[model samples]
Target: MMSSSPESRIASLGLTLPSGATPLANYVPYRKSGHLVFVSGQLPKEVKEDGSAFFHQGKLGESCTVEEGQAAAKACGLNMIAQVDKLKRPAEVISRR
Candidate 1:
C-alpha cells in the first residue's frame, strides 16, 4: 500500500492553510541565509470575513486549558507549513531526526 503524502495527511486531519500567512508585525515570516532558512513568530491566527485577524490568546498553564493549547499549537504548525510552502520548499524538510 502506498503511504499517504503530507498534503493528504493534512487533509485527512481536516486542517487547511490559513487564508493569510503573513506575520502580524513588521518582521518577515522567514529568512534564508546560505543553506539554512530561519523561521520565527508564527502564531495561531485566522483572517475573518471582514478582513480582520483573530489571534489565539492566553498563555499555556495559565489561562489556557490543555486542549486549547493543543489546538493553538496545531494552528501554529499549519501556519508554519504555510510559510514553508510560500518559500517553495517541501514540509518534509522538517523531520523527526
Candidate 2:
C-alpha cells in the first residue's frame, strides 16, 4: 500500500488528522497552558452509539476481521487527533501513575 506522505494519505482518504487523540475517560482530551498542547490516550470506537463492536478481548486474526480491525484502529487514531484539537496550546497532563 504505497502512497504519498501520511498527511497526504489521510487527505486522499478524505480525512484530516486532528491535533491529537480524544480522551476516553471523563478527563478533557487535551490541555493548554502556553503555546503548546497536550493530549491523552485515544481509542477507536463506532462513531454512532448504534454501531456494533463484534470484536473485543479477541485477537484480530482469530475473531476480528481485517476490515473490523481497520475500523477500530481508525477510530483510535481519530480520538488522538480530537484530543490535540481541543487545546489552544500544550498543557501539562497529570497521570494516575
Candidate 3:
C-alpha cells in the first residue's frame, strides 16, 4: 500500500498551504507533549509577497456578512493547518474548538 504525503494531499485538494506565522505575543505557537500537540489560536491572515499581512478584521455579527464570516473562518482554519503542517508530521485533526 502507498501512503500519500501531507503536502501531496494538500496539493491534490487544489489548495496551497500558506506560510507559517510568527506568534504575536511572548508565547510559543505550539506545544508538543508526548503524542499530543496544542496549537495556539490563529487568525484569518495571509502574508503577502512584500511581507504585509492581509486579513479580514471585523466582528462576525456586526460588520461582516454571513458569507464573509464563513470565508474568514475558512481562512483561519487554513492558517491553523499551516501551523500544524510546519511540524513536519502527519496531523489528524480531531476537532476544532
Candidate 3, residue 76: lDDT: 83
Q: Is candidate 1 or candidate 2 better by TM-score?
A: 1
Which runs of model 2 end up more than 4 angstroms from their true locations?
A: 1-12, 16-26, 31-38, 49-57, 89-97
What is candidate 1's lDDT per residue for 1-97, written digit by digit as tens? 8898677988898877775465568998888776666778778776667978777889899998888888787878887787776666543454332
TM-score versus the correct structure, for each prediction: 0.73, 0.47, 0.74
TM-score ranking, best first: 3, 1, 2
How much lDDT does each candidate structure score? Answer: 0.74, 0.58, 0.78
Kindly report which residue pairs in candidate 1 clash with one another: none
What shift in Å separates residue 90 of candidate 3 from its native position after superposition? 3.5
lDDT of 2 at 28: 71
Q: Compared to the true structure, candidate 2 yields what TM-score? A: 0.47
Error of 1 at 55 (Å): 1.6
TM-score quality measure for candidate 3: 0.74
Task: Write down the RMSD of all candidates, one decimal each.
Answer: 3.2, 6.9, 2.7
After the best TM-score superposition of candidate 1, give how far the Cα of residue 3 lies from its true spot, in angstroms: 3.3
- Tens-digit lDDT string for candidate 2 (7-90): 576778898654453344789765565665555555554345464433223468998789878877777666665565454443
State in Å the error of residue 27, model 2.
3.9
